[model samples]
Target: MQQSKGRPRTAGAGQESSAERLDGHGREPTEDAGHLRYDDPWYDALASGWGESAGAGEPVPAVVAAARREDESRGAAADVYLEVQRSAAFQEVRRRYRRFVVPACVAFFAWYVGYVVAATTAPELMARPVAGAVNVAMAAGLGQFATTFLLTWAYARHARLRRDRAALELRWDTQELTRGVDGGAS
Candidate 1:
């Protein structure tokens, strides 16, 4: 890295390089922006430096020791999750989820594609007036939006009514198994 005589000096050991700090649009990242979404399920807090660093890196020998320990712990944790996943309770919950989701997704896709096919292939039918200046195309287009909301509501309602309790119980069971407090805490 060649230092340009005219370039501004940046202090290390305190902050990342200004070039690295800039966002995709060449603008600096805003501190006030809400980056973490508590409501979101897909947020990766560990990878995002939310709480702390990956420990045991200060000493050279401890890093090697920690690496061995980490590998063992990871394998054991993986096995526990794999075991829980293969359990009948987990399978039942998954089955219930799939039972509702698969059919609902298929039906919704069919409905949407059917509408598109009707609009494109059968223009005369779509153009047929339902009421004063309100054609079948308009009605069907509106039906698409209606069905979207209907399906969303139905999915949520079904999950809450049928699967939520069983899924919650399954989650609790998995958590308890993973806690491993009896001299086996990983």
Candidate 2:
């Protein structure tokens, strides 16, 4: 009996018409193209492994299945914990800003509105100053700019230190993964 060839030959030769119709020549097909399935590679690999196992006269053992289950559980737990830590850090930063930055910004806007109203309504009073050559509005506005700059500079320094610490921790974790001493596949 003659074995039929797999997959039909269309109206094209190698690396010419069919290549342009898909991606470039030598590119693999994608899932949406409908010519191939998503699990093709994994299923093909599994089928190939079955041939090897049959030749060796051994089936899959139960201990390997149990170990794989345990490994999958541990991996899922690690992923969940990492996600929690990431989200917790984000929430903490937002909480810190909410506790200080939000109220400060609201107070600043309120003060600004008050200043504009007072400057428009009572220019003579605002122009009078406690110190030489500096009126009350000028002093207050200058104080606001100074406070904003100091806060921004301090926050920048704090953020840089925090990021450096986080990076160092991540580097250590990555080093541990690279060592592969935890019985995990690299």
Candidate 3:
């Protein structure tokens, strides 16, 4: 069998190497084979199975039980959240968002692409002076920025006017439902 000079390869060997058997520390094993080589007392005790079996079949403490109950309540609250997510109100909000965003994105992208194509293909037209030093290209480029801000304001206004109240009501309703399920303490 081929062998390396450092530690012997323990691939097919029955025993583990000292490195493999290290108990959370880099130290080699001591004279007592049962004791772990860890420097921390807690780690040594843990490795030796200390205090492990004491609470094996015991009932959970009140604090732990309360925490578990809270976790279960939170899990149930998550189900309430999911129900709200699947509700018509939530779906309507999403629909409104998509309705605005999709068309706006498509129009803006098309306008941008048209601007780029015009700039590249019709350089002479783009170079035509609109005012003093500002040309058609400059005006169109500035228009892109103006359109972006206008679209942003319009979207925000639409959301505020049309969807925000409904969506907010839905959120409040969901929160109330979850709080009720959690015994009115959210």
Q: Rank the models by lDDT, top first.
A: 3, 1, 2
**Candidate 3 residue 146 C-alpha distance from true site, Å:** 0.9
- Candidate 3 collision pairs: none
Candidate 1 per-residue lDDT over residues 28-141, each given as its tens digit: 346665442222233223332222222422211112444556567667667778988898988887898899999999998999999999999999999999999999999999
Whole-model Cα lDDT per candidate? 0.65, 0.54, 0.73
Cand. 2 Cα-lDDT: 0.54
Per-residue alpha-carbon lDDT of candidate 2 for residues 1-186, written as tens digits (9 for 90 to 100): 101122223445345344434422113356678864222122222232321232343422323344666567568657645654576554565566466657767777887788789889998888998699999879877877887787788666765655546555655665465445345644
| Candidate that would win on TM-score | 1
Compared with the true structure, model 1 gives a TM-score of: 0.63
Residue 91, candidate 1: C-alpha displacement in angstroms: 0.9
Q: What is the TM-score of each predicted model, taking all chains together?
A: 0.63, 0.38, 0.62
Query: Runs in model 3 with CA error above 4 Å?
Result: 1-67
Clashing pairs in 2: none
